[model samples]
Target: MNVDFVDSAAVQDLLDRASGVRTEGGDARIKAITRDLIEAVMRAIVKYDIDESEFWRAITFFQNGAPEFGLIAPGVGIEHFLDLYMDAKDADAGLTGGTPRTIEGPLYVEGAPLVEGEVNLTDDADDTGTLIMNGSVRGPDGEPVGNAIVHVWHANSKGFYSHFDPTGEQTPFNNRRRIRVDSDGRYSFRSRMPNGYSVPPGGATDRLMSTLGRHGNRPAHVHFFIEAPGYRTLTTQINFGDDPFAADDFAFGTREGLLPVPNRQGDSASIAFDFRLQRATTEKDEGFSSRTRATA
Candidate 1:
Protein backbone atom coordinates (compact mmCIF):
# COMPACT_ATOMS: atom_id res chain seq x y z
CA MET A 1 0.00 0.00 0.00
CA ASN A 2 1.23 3.54 -0.82
CA VAL A 3 0.87 5.32 2.52
CA ASP A 4 2.43 8.53 1.18
CA PHE A 5 -0.59 8.88 -1.02
CA VAL A 6 -2.71 9.08 2.16
CA ASP A 7 -1.83 12.80 2.15
CA SER A 8 0.98 14.55 4.05
CA ALA A 9 -1.26 17.63 4.32
CA ALA A 10 -3.82 15.75 6.43
CA VAL A 11 -1.11 14.38 8.71
CA GLN A 12 0.30 17.87 9.22
CA ASP A 13 -3.20 19.19 9.97
CA LEU A 14 -3.68 16.56 12.66
CA LEU A 15 -0.29 17.38 14.22
CA ASP A 16 -1.11 21.08 14.30
CA ARG A 17 -4.43 20.44 16.01
CA ALA A 18 -2.79 18.12 18.53
CA SER A 19 -0.21 20.76 19.40
CA GLY A 20 -2.94 23.38 19.83
CA VAL A 21 -5.01 21.12 22.05
CA ARG A 22 -2.06 20.24 24.26
CA THR A 23 -1.05 23.89 24.71
CA GLU A 24 -1.52 25.54 28.14
CA GLY A 25 -0.19 28.50 30.09
CA GLY A 26 3.54 28.89 29.44
CA ASP A 27 3.06 26.42 26.58
CA ALA A 28 4.03 28.71 23.74
CA ARG A 29 7.52 27.30 24.14
CA ILE A 30 6.12 23.75 24.09
CA LYS A 31 4.10 24.50 20.95
CA ALA A 32 7.20 25.77 19.22
CA ILE A 33 9.02 22.58 20.23
CA THR A 34 6.15 20.45 18.96
CA ARG A 35 6.18 22.29 15.62
CA ASP A 36 9.92 21.80 15.29
CA LEU A 37 9.62 18.08 16.11
CA ILE A 38 6.87 17.59 13.52
CA GLU A 39 8.88 19.49 10.92
CA ALA A 40 11.90 17.33 11.66
CA VAL A 41 9.90 14.12 11.28
CA MET A 42 8.45 15.33 7.99
CA ARG A 43 11.90 16.27 6.76
CA ALA A 44 13.31 12.90 7.76
CA ILE A 45 10.55 11.11 5.94
CA VAL A 46 11.30 12.98 2.75
CA LYS A 47 15.09 13.24 2.94
CA TYR A 48 16.00 9.89 4.45
CA ASP A 49 13.33 7.72 2.82
CA ILE A 50 11.90 6.86 6.26
CA ASP A 51 8.80 4.84 5.62
CA GLU A 52 5.58 5.04 7.66
CA SER A 53 6.38 1.79 9.46
CA GLU A 54 9.83 3.02 10.48
CA PHE A 55 8.41 6.34 11.67
CA TRP A 56 5.75 4.63 13.74
CA ARG A 57 8.35 2.27 15.20
CA ALA A 58 10.45 5.23 16.32
CA ILE A 59 7.41 6.83 17.97
CA THR A 60 6.55 3.59 19.74
CA PHE A 61 10.07 3.18 21.09
CA PHE A 62 10.10 6.73 22.45
CA GLN A 63 6.67 6.38 24.01
CA ASN A 64 7.41 3.08 25.69
CA GLY A 65 11.11 3.24 26.67
CA ALA A 66 12.33 6.82 26.59
CA PRO A 67 11.23 7.76 30.11
CA GLU A 68 13.50 5.20 31.77
CA PHE A 69 16.41 6.22 29.56
CA GLY A 70 15.72 9.88 30.26
CA LEU A 71 16.37 9.32 33.99
CA ILE A 72 20.03 8.56 33.29
CA ALA A 73 20.50 11.04 30.47
CA PRO A 74 21.73 13.74 32.85
CA GLY A 75 24.78 11.65 33.70
CA VAL A 76 25.77 11.95 30.05
CA GLY A 77 24.98 15.70 29.69
CA ILE A 78 21.53 15.47 28.06
CA GLU A 79 19.91 16.89 31.21
CA HIS A 80 21.91 20.10 30.94
CA PHE A 81 19.19 21.82 28.93
CA LEU A 82 17.77 23.40 32.07
CA ASP A 83 21.20 24.28 33.45
CA LEU A 84 22.21 25.84 30.16
CA TYR A 85 19.09 27.97 30.17
CA MET A 86 19.80 29.09 33.74
CA ASP A 87 23.43 29.80 32.92
CA ALA A 88 22.48 32.00 30.01
CA LYS A 89 20.07 33.94 32.17
CA ASP A 90 22.71 34.33 34.88
CA ALA A 91 25.28 35.57 32.38
CA ASP A 92 22.85 38.10 30.97
CA ALA A 93 22.08 39.40 34.44
CA GLY A 94 25.79 39.50 35.53
CA LEU A 95 25.26 36.85 38.21
CA THR A 96 27.99 34.53 37.02
CA GLY A 97 31.14 32.93 38.42
CA GLY A 98 31.84 31.45 41.83
CA THR A 99 32.01 27.68 41.55
CA PRO A 100 30.68 25.65 38.64
CA ARG A 101 27.61 23.58 39.48
CA THR A 102 27.61 19.80 39.25
CA ILE A 103 24.83 17.23 39.20
CA GLU A 104 23.56 15.96 42.57
CA GLY A 105 24.01 12.21 42.84
CA PRO A 106 21.19 9.82 43.76
CA LEU A 107 22.36 9.53 47.39
CA TYR A 108 21.29 12.85 48.90
CA VAL A 109 18.96 12.51 51.93
CA GLU A 110 17.83 15.29 54.30
CA GLY A 111 17.28 15.81 58.07
CA ALA A 112 20.53 14.88 59.70
CA PRO A 113 21.14 16.29 63.14
CA LEU A 114 21.69 20.05 63.42
CA VAL A 115 24.97 20.35 65.29
CA GLU A 116 26.33 23.48 66.93
CA GLY A 117 29.94 24.11 65.88
CA GLU A 118 31.08 20.65 64.86
CA VAL A 119 30.09 17.00 65.17
CA ASN A 120 32.16 13.92 64.64
CA LEU A 121 30.34 12.49 61.63
CA THR A 122 32.00 9.15 62.25
CA ASP A 123 31.25 8.99 65.95
CA ASP A 124 30.17 5.37 65.71
CA ALA A 125 33.50 4.24 64.30
CA ASP A 126 36.41 3.23 66.54
CA ASP A 127 39.04 5.16 64.56
CA THR A 128 40.49 8.02 66.59
CA GLY A 129 41.59 10.03 63.55
CA THR A 130 39.77 13.40 63.45
CA LEU A 131 38.92 15.51 60.39
CA ILE A 132 37.80 19.09 60.86
CA MET A 133 36.23 20.77 57.82
CA ASN A 134 35.84 24.52 58.26
CA GLY A 135 34.80 26.88 55.54
CA SER A 136 33.24 30.25 54.97
CA VAL A 137 30.35 30.59 52.58
CA ARG A 138 31.19 33.59 50.49
CA GLY A 139 29.28 35.36 47.73
CA PRO A 140 30.55 36.22 44.25
CA ASP A 141 31.91 39.53 45.53
CA GLY A 142 34.01 37.76 48.20
CA GLU A 143 31.69 38.74 51.04
CA PRO A 144 30.80 36.19 53.66
CA VAL A 145 27.26 34.78 53.58
CA GLY A 146 26.45 34.44 57.25
CA ASN A 147 23.71 32.26 58.70
CA ALA A 148 23.83 30.09 55.62
CA ILE A 149 22.64 26.52 55.98
CA VAL A 150 25.24 23.96 54.96
CA HIS A 151 24.31 20.30 54.58
CA VAL A 152 27.06 17.67 54.63
CA TRP A 153 26.89 13.94 53.90
CA HIS A 154 29.25 11.23 52.75
CA ALA A 155 29.86 7.48 52.64
CA ASN A 156 31.03 5.86 55.84
CA SER A 157 34.40 4.11 56.36
CA LYS A 158 33.07 1.16 54.36
CA GLY A 159 32.09 3.23 51.31
CA PHE A 160 28.39 2.73 51.94
CA TYR A 161 25.92 5.58 52.34
CA SER A 162 23.28 5.37 55.03
CA HIS A 163 19.74 4.46 54.01
CA PHE A 164 21.22 2.68 50.99
CA ASP A 165 22.82 0.00 53.12
CA PRO A 166 20.58 -2.94 53.94
CA THR A 167 22.36 -3.74 57.22
CA GLY A 168 22.31 -0.20 58.59
CA GLU A 169 20.11 1.03 61.40
CA GLN A 170 16.85 2.81 60.55
CA THR A 171 17.08 6.15 62.33
CA PRO A 172 17.33 9.65 60.91
CA PHE A 173 19.44 9.56 57.76
CA ASN A 174 23.06 8.69 58.56
CA ASN A 175 26.19 10.76 57.84
CA ARG A 176 24.16 13.87 57.08
CA ARG A 177 23.64 17.20 58.79
CA ARG A 178 22.23 20.69 58.31
CA ILE A 179 24.75 23.06 59.94
CA ARG A 180 24.08 26.75 60.05
CA VAL A 181 27.08 28.96 59.44
CA ASP A 182 27.89 31.36 62.24
CA SER A 183 28.16 35.14 62.06
CA ASP A 184 31.70 34.78 60.72
CA GLY A 185 30.51 32.47 57.96
CA ARG A 186 32.54 29.61 59.41
CA TYR A 187 31.27 26.05 59.92
CA SER A 188 33.17 22.95 60.76
CA PHE A 189 32.59 19.22 61.27
CA ARG A 190 34.55 16.12 62.18
CA SER A 191 34.29 12.87 60.26
CA ARG A 192 36.63 9.97 59.66
CA MET A 193 38.18 9.67 56.21
CA PRO A 194 36.15 7.47 53.86
CA ASN A 195 37.60 4.77 51.66
CA GLY A 196 36.99 4.41 47.96
CA TYR A 197 34.06 2.30 46.82
CA SER A 198 32.93 0.81 43.54
CA VAL A 199 29.57 1.34 41.88
CA PRO A 200 26.73 -1.18 42.16
CA PRO A 201 28.96 -3.61 40.17
CA GLY A 202 26.12 -5.31 38.27
CA GLY A 203 23.51 -2.68 37.49
CA ALA A 204 22.99 -0.80 34.26
CA THR A 205 25.52 1.88 35.20
CA ASP A 206 28.05 -0.73 36.12
CA ARG A 207 27.37 -2.62 32.90
CA LEU A 208 28.11 0.46 30.84
CA MET A 209 31.31 1.10 32.77
CA SER A 210 32.43 -2.49 32.31
CA THR A 211 31.83 -2.33 28.57
CA LEU A 212 33.95 0.82 28.45
CA GLY A 213 36.74 -0.92 30.38
CA ARG A 214 36.39 1.50 33.26
CA HIS A 215 36.21 1.07 37.01
CA GLY A 216 33.51 2.80 38.99
CA ASN A 217 35.60 3.49 42.09
CA ARG A 218 34.84 6.86 43.69
CA PRO A 219 37.63 8.38 45.80
CA ALA A 220 37.29 9.33 49.44
CA HIS A 221 35.53 12.68 49.72
CA VAL A 222 32.93 14.50 51.79
CA HIS A 223 29.79 15.90 50.17
CA PHE A 224 28.55 19.37 51.00
CA PHE A 225 25.44 21.28 49.97
CA ILE A 226 25.27 24.95 51.04
CA GLU A 227 22.31 27.28 50.79
CA ALA A 228 21.68 30.80 52.00
CA PRO A 229 18.76 33.17 51.46
CA GLY A 230 20.36 35.27 48.69
CA TYR A 231 23.10 32.95 47.61
CA ARG A 232 22.79 30.25 45.00
CA THR A 233 22.91 26.76 46.47
CA LEU A 234 26.25 24.96 46.05
CA THR A 235 26.55 21.19 45.87
CA THR A 236 30.18 20.07 45.88
CA GLN A 237 32.60 17.54 47.37
CA ILE A 238 35.76 18.11 49.39
CA ASN A 239 38.28 15.52 48.30
CA PHE A 240 40.68 14.08 50.88
CA GLY A 241 43.78 16.20 50.46
CA ASP A 242 46.05 13.18 50.00
CA ASP A 243 43.86 10.50 48.44
CA PRO A 244 45.49 8.58 45.57
CA PHE A 245 42.51 9.25 43.30
CA ALA A 246 42.09 12.90 44.23
CA ALA A 247 43.15 13.96 40.78
CA ASP A 248 40.81 11.53 39.06
CA ASP A 249 37.41 11.16 40.68
CA PHE A 250 35.17 8.50 39.16
CA ALA A 251 32.34 11.01 39.01
CA PHE A 252 34.67 13.59 37.39
CA GLY A 253 33.68 16.11 40.07
CA THR A 254 37.14 17.09 41.20
CA ARG A 255 37.88 20.80 40.88
CA GLU A 256 41.16 22.54 41.69
CA GLY A 257 39.52 24.86 44.21
CA LEU A 258 37.52 22.10 45.92
CA LEU A 259 40.46 20.13 47.33
CA PRO A 260 41.40 21.30 50.82
CA VAL A 261 44.77 20.98 52.54
CA PRO A 262 44.88 18.25 55.18
CA ASN A 263 46.64 18.72 58.48
CA ARG A 264 47.61 15.24 59.56
CA GLN A 265 49.45 14.04 62.66
CA GLY A 266 49.51 10.89 64.75
CA ASP A 267 46.10 9.31 64.22
CA SER A 268 44.49 12.75 63.77
CA ALA A 269 43.85 14.99 60.77
CA SER A 270 41.99 18.18 60.00
CA ILE A 271 41.08 20.03 56.83
CA ALA A 272 39.96 23.63 56.37
CA PHE A 273 38.13 24.80 53.26
CA ASP A 274 36.44 28.00 52.24
CA PHE A 275 33.40 27.81 49.96
CA ARG A 276 32.32 30.55 47.58
CA LEU A 277 28.72 30.73 46.35
CA GLN A 278 27.08 32.77 43.65
CA ARG A 279 24.28 35.25 44.42
CA ALA A 280 20.81 34.10 43.45
CA THR A 281 19.01 36.63 41.29
CA THR A 282 15.71 34.89 40.60
CA GLU A 283 13.29 32.70 42.49
CA LYS A 284 14.04 29.77 40.17
CA ASP A 285 17.56 29.72 41.60
CA GLU A 286 16.34 28.85 45.09
CA GLY A 287 17.61 25.69 46.77
CA PHE A 288 15.83 22.38 46.46
CA SER A 289 13.71 20.88 49.22
CA SER A 290 15.37 18.66 51.82
CA ARG A 291 14.94 14.90 51.56
CA THR A 292 16.89 13.92 54.69
CA ARG A 293 13.87 13.02 56.79
CA ALA A 294 12.38 10.74 54.15
CA THR A 295 14.96 8.00 54.48
CA ALA A 296 13.95 4.61 55.87
Candidate 2:
Protein backbone atom coordinates (compact mmCIF):
# COMPACT_ATOMS: atom_id res chain seq x y z
CA MET A 1 0.00 0.00 0.00
CA ASN A 2 1.20 3.51 -0.79
CA VAL A 3 0.84 6.48 1.56
CA ASP A 4 0.04 9.93 0.21
CA PHE A 5 0.11 12.77 2.73
CA VAL A 6 2.88 14.54 0.79
CA ASP A 7 0.38 16.76 -0.97
CA SER A 8 -2.04 17.14 1.89
CA ALA A 9 -2.88 20.64 3.18
CA ALA A 10 -1.87 19.53 6.69
CA VAL A 11 1.65 18.67 5.57
CA GLN A 12 1.98 21.89 3.59
CA ASP A 13 0.94 23.96 6.60
CA LEU A 14 3.40 22.15 8.82
CA LEU A 15 6.22 22.73 6.34
CA ASP A 16 5.39 26.41 6.01
CA ARG A 17 5.51 26.89 9.76
CA ALA A 18 8.60 24.78 10.22
CA SER A 19 10.50 26.62 7.52
CA GLY A 20 9.72 29.99 9.11
CA VAL A 21 7.89 31.18 6.07
CA ARG A 22 6.04 33.81 8.10
CA THR A 23 9.05 34.92 10.12
CA GLU A 24 11.09 37.89 8.94
CA GLY A 25 13.72 37.74 11.65
CA GLY A 26 16.49 36.06 9.73
CA ASP A 27 17.83 36.17 6.18
CA ALA A 28 15.00 36.07 3.71
CA ARG A 29 17.05 34.18 1.17
CA ILE A 30 17.93 31.50 3.69
CA LYS A 31 14.31 31.07 4.70
CA ALA A 32 13.10 30.66 1.13
CA ILE A 33 15.80 28.15 0.33
CA THR A 34 15.06 26.23 3.49
CA ARG A 35 11.38 26.06 2.70
CA ASP A 36 12.05 24.78 -0.77
CA LEU A 37 14.51 22.18 0.53
CA ILE A 38 12.04 20.96 3.12
CA GLU A 39 9.41 20.54 0.44
CA ALA A 40 11.84 18.66 -1.71
CA VAL A 41 12.71 16.31 1.11
CA MET A 42 9.06 15.60 1.69
CA ARG A 43 8.58 14.81 -1.97
CA ALA A 44 11.55 12.48 -1.93
CA ILE A 45 10.29 10.69 1.14
CA VAL A 46 7.10 9.92 -0.65
CA LYS A 47 8.71 9.06 -3.96
CA TYR A 48 11.21 6.67 -2.45
CA ASP A 49 8.76 5.24 0.06
CA ILE A 50 11.31 5.74 2.77
CA ASP A 51 10.15 3.89 5.84
CA GLU A 52 10.36 5.22 9.39
CA SER A 53 13.22 2.93 10.36
CA GLU A 54 15.38 3.95 7.41
CA PHE A 55 14.80 7.65 8.01
CA TRP A 56 15.56 7.30 11.72
CA ARG A 57 18.69 5.33 10.95
CA ALA A 58 19.90 8.15 8.71
CA ILE A 59 19.22 10.64 11.47
CA THR A 60 21.22 8.53 13.89
CA PHE A 61 24.09 8.30 11.44
CA PHE A 62 24.37 12.10 11.36
CA GLN A 63 23.88 12.35 15.09
CA ASN A 64 26.82 10.02 15.65
CA GLY A 65 29.28 11.70 13.29
CA ALA A 66 28.13 14.74 11.41
CA PRO A 67 31.57 15.58 10.10
CA GLU A 68 31.51 12.50 7.93
CA PHE A 69 28.85 14.22 5.89
CA GLY A 70 31.55 16.52 4.56
CA LEU A 71 33.55 13.56 3.30
CA ILE A 72 30.43 11.95 1.94
CA ALA A 73 29.60 15.07 -0.06
CA PRO A 74 32.77 14.80 -2.11
CA GLY A 75 32.60 11.04 -2.19
CA VAL A 76 29.18 11.25 -3.84
CA GLY A 77 30.13 14.09 -6.25
CA ILE A 78 28.12 16.90 -4.66
CA GLU A 79 31.23 19.03 -4.31
CA HIS A 80 32.25 18.41 -7.90
CA PHE A 81 28.77 19.13 -9.13
CA LEU A 82 29.05 22.60 -7.65
CA ASP A 83 32.18 23.28 -9.70
CA LEU A 84 30.48 21.93 -12.82
CA TYR A 85 27.46 24.11 -12.15
CA MET A 86 29.65 27.19 -11.90
CA ASP A 87 31.40 26.22 -15.12
CA ALA A 88 28.06 25.87 -16.87
CA LYS A 89 27.03 29.30 -15.65
CA ASP A 90 30.27 30.74 -16.93
CA ALA A 91 29.73 29.09 -20.30
CA ASP A 92 26.26 30.56 -20.50
CA ALA A 93 27.78 33.99 -19.89
CA GLY A 94 30.40 33.47 -22.63
CA LEU A 95 33.13 33.37 -19.97
CA THR A 96 35.38 30.48 -20.89
CA GLY A 97 39.10 29.72 -21.12
CA GLY A 98 42.02 29.34 -18.74
CA THR A 99 42.64 26.51 -16.26
CA PRO A 100 39.58 24.46 -15.41
CA ARG A 101 38.28 24.82 -11.83
CA THR A 102 37.68 21.83 -9.59
CA ILE A 103 36.50 21.00 -6.13
CA GLU A 104 38.61 22.24 -3.17
CA GLY A 105 38.18 18.93 -1.32
CA PRO A 106 37.84 20.18 2.29
CA LEU A 107 41.53 19.71 3.10
CA TYR A 108 42.98 23.18 2.71
CA VAL A 109 44.32 25.16 5.66
CA GLU A 110 44.98 28.86 5.77
CA GLY A 111 48.12 30.80 6.70
CA ALA A 112 50.96 29.00 4.99
CA PRO A 113 54.17 31.05 5.09
CA LEU A 114 54.63 33.10 1.92
CA VAL A 115 57.79 32.54 -0.09
CA GLU A 116 59.45 34.26 -3.02
CA GLY A 117 59.80 32.45 -6.37
CA GLU A 118 60.70 28.98 -5.07
CA VAL A 119 60.59 26.84 -1.94
CA ASN A 120 61.17 23.29 -0.72
CA LEU A 121 57.96 21.56 0.36
CA THR A 122 59.74 18.68 2.03
CA ASP A 123 62.51 18.36 4.57
CA ASP A 124 65.97 17.08 3.54
CA ALA A 125 65.97 13.84 5.51
CA ASP A 126 62.70 12.39 4.16
CA ASP A 127 63.52 9.30 2.07
CA THR A 128 60.55 9.73 -0.27
CA GLY A 129 61.37 10.28 -3.94
CA THR A 130 61.76 13.90 -4.89
CA LEU A 131 59.14 15.71 -7.00
CA ILE A 132 60.36 18.72 -8.92
CA MET A 133 57.54 20.92 -10.22
CA ASN A 134 58.41 23.95 -12.36
CA GLY A 135 55.65 26.14 -13.63
CA SER A 136 54.57 29.67 -14.49
CA VAL A 137 51.31 31.53 -14.19
CA ARG A 138 50.20 33.05 -17.46
CA GLY A 139 47.16 34.93 -18.67
CA PRO A 140 44.75 33.45 -21.21
CA ASP A 141 46.72 35.31 -23.85
CA GLY A 142 49.92 33.44 -22.84
CA GLU A 143 51.62 36.44 -21.21
CA PRO A 144 53.17 36.00 -17.80
CA VAL A 145 50.95 37.10 -14.96
CA GLY A 146 53.28 38.03 -12.15
CA ASN A 147 52.26 39.22 -8.68
CA ALA A 148 50.29 36.01 -8.15
CA ILE A 149 50.05 33.90 -5.03
CA VAL A 150 50.17 30.14 -5.45
CA HIS A 151 48.99 28.24 -2.39
CA VAL A 152 49.93 24.60 -2.77
CA TRP A 153 49.29 21.55 -0.60
CA HIS A 154 49.45 17.80 -1.02
CA ALA A 155 49.52 14.53 0.84
CA ASN A 156 52.69 12.76 1.90
CA SER A 157 54.09 9.50 0.57
CA LYS A 158 51.47 7.59 2.55
CA GLY A 159 48.70 9.82 1.19
CA PHE A 160 48.16 11.52 4.53
CA TYR A 161 47.88 15.27 4.75
CA SER A 162 49.41 17.43 7.47
CA HIS A 163 47.14 18.29 10.39
CA PHE A 164 44.79 15.49 9.30
CA ASP A 165 47.12 12.50 9.49
CA PRO A 166 45.90 9.98 11.99
CA THR A 167 49.50 8.81 12.41
CA GLY A 168 50.38 12.04 14.27
CA GLU A 169 53.77 12.31 12.57
CA GLN A 170 53.35 15.26 10.23
CA THR A 171 54.26 18.76 11.39
CA PRO A 172 52.08 21.80 10.83
CA PHE A 173 51.94 22.78 7.17
CA ASN A 174 54.18 19.90 6.16
CA ASN A 175 54.31 19.57 2.35
CA ARG A 176 52.46 22.89 2.06
CA ARG A 177 53.79 26.16 0.67
CA ARG A 178 52.58 29.52 -0.53
CA ILE A 179 54.87 30.61 -3.33
CA ARG A 180 54.69 34.13 -4.65
CA VAL A 181 55.22 34.23 -8.39
CA ASP A 182 58.29 36.18 -9.50
CA SER A 183 58.32 39.02 -12.02
CA ASP A 184 58.18 36.39 -14.76
CA GLY A 185 55.36 34.42 -13.09
CA ARG A 186 57.62 31.44 -12.44
CA TYR A 187 57.43 29.25 -9.33
CA SER A 188 58.97 25.92 -8.51
CA PHE A 189 59.02 23.49 -5.61
CA ARG A 190 60.67 20.22 -4.71
CA SER A 191 58.61 17.82 -2.63
CA ARG A 192 57.99 14.17 -2.04
CA MET A 193 55.58 12.29 -4.27
CA PRO A 194 52.13 11.74 -2.82
CA ASN A 195 50.31 8.42 -3.17
CA GLY A 196 46.71 7.59 -3.76
CA TYR A 197 44.58 6.81 -0.68
CA SER A 198 41.20 5.41 0.18
CA VAL A 199 38.71 6.83 2.61
CA PRO A 200 38.72 6.05 6.30
CA PRO A 201 38.11 2.34 6.66
CA GLY A 202 34.53 1.38 7.57
CA GLY A 203 33.67 5.03 8.12
CA ALA A 204 30.59 6.92 6.96
CA THR A 205 31.95 7.61 3.51
CA ASP A 206 33.12 4.05 3.13
CA ARG A 207 29.81 2.64 4.32
CA LEU A 208 27.86 4.77 1.84
CA MET A 209 30.27 3.91 -0.92
CA SER A 210 29.77 0.21 -0.28
CA THR A 211 26.00 0.54 -0.43
CA LEU A 212 26.24 2.60 -3.60
CA GLY A 213 28.63 0.15 -5.30
CA ARG A 214 31.41 2.71 -5.41
CA HIS A 215 34.87 3.09 -3.91
CA GLY A 216 36.17 6.02 -1.94
CA ASN A 217 39.62 6.32 -3.40
CA ARG A 218 41.38 9.40 -4.74
CA PRO A 219 44.43 9.59 -7.01
CA ALA A 220 47.76 11.01 -5.96
CA HIS A 221 47.35 14.67 -6.77
CA VAL A 222 48.50 18.18 -5.93
CA HIS A 223 46.21 21.07 -5.12
CA PHE A 224 46.66 24.75 -5.97
CA PHE A 225 44.97 28.06 -5.33
CA ILE A 226 46.21 30.64 -7.83
CA GLU A 227 45.16 34.25 -7.51
CA ALA A 228 46.46 37.46 -9.03
CA PRO A 229 45.13 40.98 -8.83
CA GLY A 230 42.56 41.72 -11.55
CA TYR A 231 42.33 38.03 -12.54
CA ARG A 232 39.82 35.40 -11.47
CA THR A 233 41.15 33.12 -8.75
CA LEU A 234 41.62 29.50 -9.88
CA THR A 235 40.99 26.57 -7.59
CA THR A 236 42.41 23.57 -9.41
CA GLN A 237 44.72 20.59 -9.07
CA ILE A 238 46.74 18.17 -11.17
CA ASN A 239 46.53 14.40 -10.97
CA PHE A 240 49.40 12.10 -11.79
CA GLY A 241 48.61 10.28 -15.01
CA ASP A 242 50.18 7.13 -13.64
CA ASP A 243 47.94 6.81 -10.59
CA PRO A 244 45.42 4.00 -10.87
CA PHE A 245 42.61 6.27 -9.80
CA ALA A 246 43.71 9.26 -11.82
CA ALA A 247 40.83 9.06 -14.27
CA ASP A 248 38.41 7.46 -11.84
CA ASP A 249 38.83 9.85 -8.93
CA PHE A 250 36.03 9.45 -6.41
CA ALA A 251 35.84 13.19 -5.96
CA PHE A 252 35.66 13.80 -9.72
CA GLY A 253 38.53 16.27 -9.40
CA THR A 254 40.44 15.21 -12.49
CA ARG A 255 39.97 17.19 -15.69
CA GLU A 256 41.40 16.62 -19.17
CA GLY A 257 43.99 19.41 -19.10
CA LEU A 258 44.95 18.85 -15.44
CA LEU A 259 46.53 15.42 -15.74
CA PRO A 260 50.28 15.58 -16.29
CA VAL A 261 52.55 12.60 -16.76
CA PRO A 262 55.53 12.52 -14.43
CA ASN A 263 58.92 12.39 -16.10
CA ARG A 264 61.07 10.12 -14.00
CA GLN A 265 64.82 9.93 -13.50
CA GLY A 266 66.93 8.24 -10.85
CA ASP A 267 65.26 8.76 -7.45
CA SER A 268 63.42 11.85 -8.68
CA ALA A 269 60.62 12.93 -10.99
CA SER A 270 59.61 16.22 -12.59
CA ILE A 271 56.37 17.65 -13.93
CA ALA A 272 55.98 20.76 -16.04
CA PHE A 273 52.56 22.36 -16.19
CA ASP A 274 51.71 26.04 -16.52
CA PHE A 275 48.62 27.68 -15.03
CA ARG A 276 46.46 30.22 -16.81
CA LEU A 277 44.24 32.95 -15.43
CA GLN A 278 41.41 35.04 -16.80
CA ARG A 279 40.71 38.71 -16.24
CA ALA A 280 38.00 39.34 -13.68
CA THR A 281 35.01 41.38 -14.68
CA THR A 282 34.03 42.11 -11.11
CA GLU A 283 35.74 42.36 -7.73
CA LYS A 284 33.97 39.25 -6.46
CA ASP A 285 35.63 37.19 -9.17
CA GLU A 286 39.10 37.95 -7.80
CA GLY A 287 38.66 36.22 -4.43
CA PHE A 288 38.02 32.79 -3.01
CA SER A 289 34.62 31.75 -1.86
CA SER A 290 33.45 32.19 1.75
CA ARG A 291 33.11 28.47 2.43
CA THR A 292 34.03 27.51 5.97
CA ARG A 293 37.71 26.53 5.97
CA ALA A 294 40.30 25.51 8.51
CA THR A 295 42.87 28.07 9.60
CA ALA A 296 45.95 27.63 11.70
Best by lDDT: 2
For residues 52-164, what per-residue lDDT tens digits would candidate 2 score against the true structure?
A: 99999988877775777668888888989999899999999999899999888888889988887568887524567889999899998998988999999999988888878
Query: Which residue ranges in model 1 land beyond 4 Å of their true spot?
Result: 1-89, 126-128, 169-171, 266-268, 289-296
Q: Write the per-residue lDDT of candidate 1 for residues 1-296, one digit (tens) a residue.
A: 34463247887777777677355565787887887787666666776778889889766755664433422344344444545666687789777687655545667675677776766565455344566677688887888888788888877767777777645642345567788888888888777666667766565545555766665666677878888888778876777757777775556655667676578886567787888888776665666745233344
Candidate whose TM-score is highest: 2
Error of 1 at 209 (Å): 1.4
**Candidates in order: C-alpha RMSD to true structure:** 5.5, 1.6
Off by over 4 Å in 2: 1-4
- TM-scores of all predicted structures: 0.71, 0.95
lDDT, residue 6, candidate 1: 27
Full-model lDDT for every candidate: 0.68, 0.88
